[model samples]
Target: MRLFVTLNFLPCSVFPSPSFPYTTQEEESGVIANHLTKHFSSSCYLSTFLLLIMSQRTLLIPLSSFFIAHLLISGAVSTTFTLTNKCGYTVWPGILSNADAPALSTTGFALQKGESKTITAPASWGGRLWGRTYCSQDSTGKFSCLTGDCGSGKLECSGTGAAPPATLAEFKLDGYGGMDYFDVSLVDGYNLPLLVVPQGGSGQNCTSTGCVVDLNDACPSELKVTSTGGESVACKSACEAFRSPQYCCNGAYGTPDTCKPSSYSEIFKNACPRAYSYAYDDKTSTFTCASADYQITFCPGPNTSQKASQETNSENTDTNTNTPLINSTMVYEGALSQNGASPSLYGSVLGSHVTAAIVSFTVAIWQWRQLF
Candidate 1:
């Protein structure tokens, strides 16, 4: 007795809809089937045909087992990363997959000003991305860069991570609870202004985050990395400069309770509150999203960085206060408001103080008249 079982599945085109969204379970299954059909041997297809010729009870057991195994083997949703360069000069972007995660197609590539590139990562892929500035080839055809070089002496970073003093965008996709965790880190130090914006995702903290300011302009004298022309290229962290256990968050200061933010770290925090200023900055730095693609932009715009530089300098004038130089919640359209107080907020505070003074004066006049 021949038993025929027909499996009905939606077409791949139906996926990525507004309601259904990207990386849904059905879409993953369909993608797996499509991939197998194109790559599987003809003998494999013949075996499936022969299985259909068996009896109803015998066919059901083996067919169900075969499908279950296929789904288990290739059932992960892929994520796409879009990298764009808005800097005036060319940027060589590098990618480094985490120890356990698989490598991507191209580990590193060049992106000219106003250019963009997209790369796809398999499910559960985790890695870091950064831009290499001042890259060039010498007489021997050896490649290298001034900042954020992976030390591979080649275009592709392969498995090597970016050297310190590079602004990094780190990601762990399809993480806990099927959510993606990402952060723009200045912990390793800041070389360029980087921003990570999630596309078509939903979460409370899924908003944009990064160091939009040009730290090189406002970088402290001790932590500044200068080029051959004496121009500041990158800013080094206190940990990188001093190599102390306290600044590195090691030894006695290993735990969060033990290690605390220092004056140097506060400088970075005051300038870019959304970025990871030090090793232990997690509360406000880390962001999460679900089923989304990410757009990583280097030097989002020129005006944003210029305004941030002015604010940072203004804040540095007064170092006695504990209050943050930048309002943590203040959001300007395209730039960061790093001032300790916004103009509107400052006006409100001043108005309240003036009213209190007038009330005291009126009471004093009344008392003097009564005494007379």
Candidate 2:
């Protein structure tokens, strides 16, 4: 006898369908066998289907908690693409960077798609996040994305927010004329500056990385420059002996990265020309030597009275004091700053700032993903 048959034959209280007419236990067994025919064979697959999907559509059990879990998982650690500006070398928080739960997200919300947000906390908080990366016995254990591509891989990038990876269309750069990135003018800071407009004159949407321009090399070259408003123009010469009368580009002062003929050609001409010093003071644009010390100062406007007094005082001051005073105009010599060095502090600062940009882009993505 089969085990199920033996169970039914024994004193068992499992209730059978009451609609069946069974005067004897043997008759009941036959009824059970007949009724089970549709389930015992290939049709048994229906039982599993019914359990998973009620009425062939609805789930047999509710998944409310799973959706909640999804929200929590998304919000927990979203910063992937991050950039910092201070030194620019902040790396994406690695497994070693976080001691416990990494404070990766900068913002608290994940938007509809590619929208991004920012958040800022004390360095101490960052330290707290950094501390957690190693101490697995502390509390929350380390987590690696299943695909191992959450931070900066093919599937993900250290973009600008803690959000889900954006679909192509969602990465709309509103108000960005089109340029993606550029090296910031050292006049501002050695940095890879973010672009706000489509760089190509065509104004078409940017699709690739070709839009960025490196501006860090702008200085230390012999190229003559003018900055009138906010734009720059350059005048390079062809040789060291070439006087100002033979103004064009040469290795005498500036780098030759420029492809312009060894004559006058524009470095930044698309924007407002007069605003840049290179364009305005074209004649006096050359810097003889980067080793030659020069002061970096916003020329005090003529409208300022404080500068006028300082200028008059410098001119009237005694020349015997070491710093030769001019005839009452205004020029003072101050101690050298750290930015004047062998490699120049500007290069290191620029490196750090660029690293920071990468960090910011990463953290921003993580922040948004966690928030929503």
Candidate 3:
């Protein structure tokens, strides 16, 4: 997803409160006219000043609406992320918030076969979510997964990204252009098949993106993550397998021109055409929408329709009770969050600076008119 971080001015002086009838400019102008007419008794000056006040008032309505519209639009809207596990076995979903961003409720949670869980992401939240396969908890409460284990040794990721060879669903909200960007990324690697679908959003290329192919079954021997039973559990990225500049796309080979897709990434790209195969794969993999909820499904293929009996688990998760089917989806309501606009979109960077200037200008007009 596109990451957007901007600092812009809030037009506080432009938008007056409902209780205050006149806008800042109009109020200042009226006060000045009243003072000048009362003290100096300057009828001609008062007439000219009132005319200017009338002109300013005429512009207030449309300008007020414009600023108000922007204010509403710029405010952050909560987005829902619904995670479903369609695999035959249980899957533990791991969440890692971006550095310095607020964490979602329960960084790690379990979903039985065909079960789903929902989480509300606040505004401008950037994070990655991945499923852990074949997880087991010891008597000491130390949990570990054969695939996508974040090394936390517990269900909670605790603000840690998944290890290599794990399929990842990444997102950043209120991104550049005021759109939410999301994508299924294999830049790290692939464990289970997954998909990210946008719901009720408007924009180009807001379509679903995922890797339906079971890369583990077809993983190359050199990049295979094997289980205790000697079966391939996940497919490791070339960078993780080789740690070379060509595979990792680092240093001298960081540029797109220098770091062309290797045979391994090409395999991933071929399997998942709409997912990120390499570090530079942005144009095709990245998807954006203005405001939309998303469904992230693991193992989202033909066999996904099969439902296994829900097993008794001791984890406390708000299971998707509305639907008994494994493939059913749920939407959650989130609180409103406000995001700042890019200064480049307008001219000012600091909202306080703009407010100060407007207040100063208004005071100057008030004082000058009172002196007359």
- Top lDDT hit: 1
Each candidate: RMSD: 22.9, 31.2, 18.2
Better of 1 and 2 by TM-score: 1
| Candidate 2 lDDT tens digits, 1-372 | 111100001111122312312121111122211111111111000001112322344332223333333223212122122221111111122111122223434311211111322333221111111000000111343332211113332212223221111000001110111111111111111112121111111111111111022222342244333333322222222221233312222223232233222222233322112111121222211111111111111111111111101122333222112221111222222322234332332343233334434443344344334534
- Candidate 1, backbone clash total: 0
lDDT of 3 by residue, 1-372 (tens): 222212233333233212211111111122211101111110000001111233233211123323433434444357898998877668889998766458898899888878999999987677788988878888999988878888888789886667777888877776544556677888788888787878766555556788765666567899998876676778888888887877776667756777778889988887678888877776677776656888888867654322221334543232223322221121212212223321222232133345434544454355335534
Error of 3 at 207 (Å): 1.3
- The collision pairs in model 1 are none
Among all windows of ten consecutive residues in candidate 2, which has the lowest summed lDDT? 166-175
TM-score of 2: 0.16
Arrange candidates, best TM-score first: 1, 3, 2
How much is the lDDT of residue 313 in candidate 1?
36
Query: 72-102, model 1: which lDDT tens digit per residue?
Result: 3223368899998876667899998866578
What is the lDDT for 246 in model 1?
A: 76
lDDT of 1: 0.63
TM-score versus the correct structure, for each prediction: 0.66, 0.16, 0.65
Could you tally the backbone clashes for each prediction? 0, 87, 2
Model 3: residue 56 alpha-carbon error in angstroms: 17
TM-score, cand. 3: 0.65
Residue ranges of candidate 2 with Cα displaced over 4 Å: 1-60, 68-77, 80-83, 87-226, 229-372
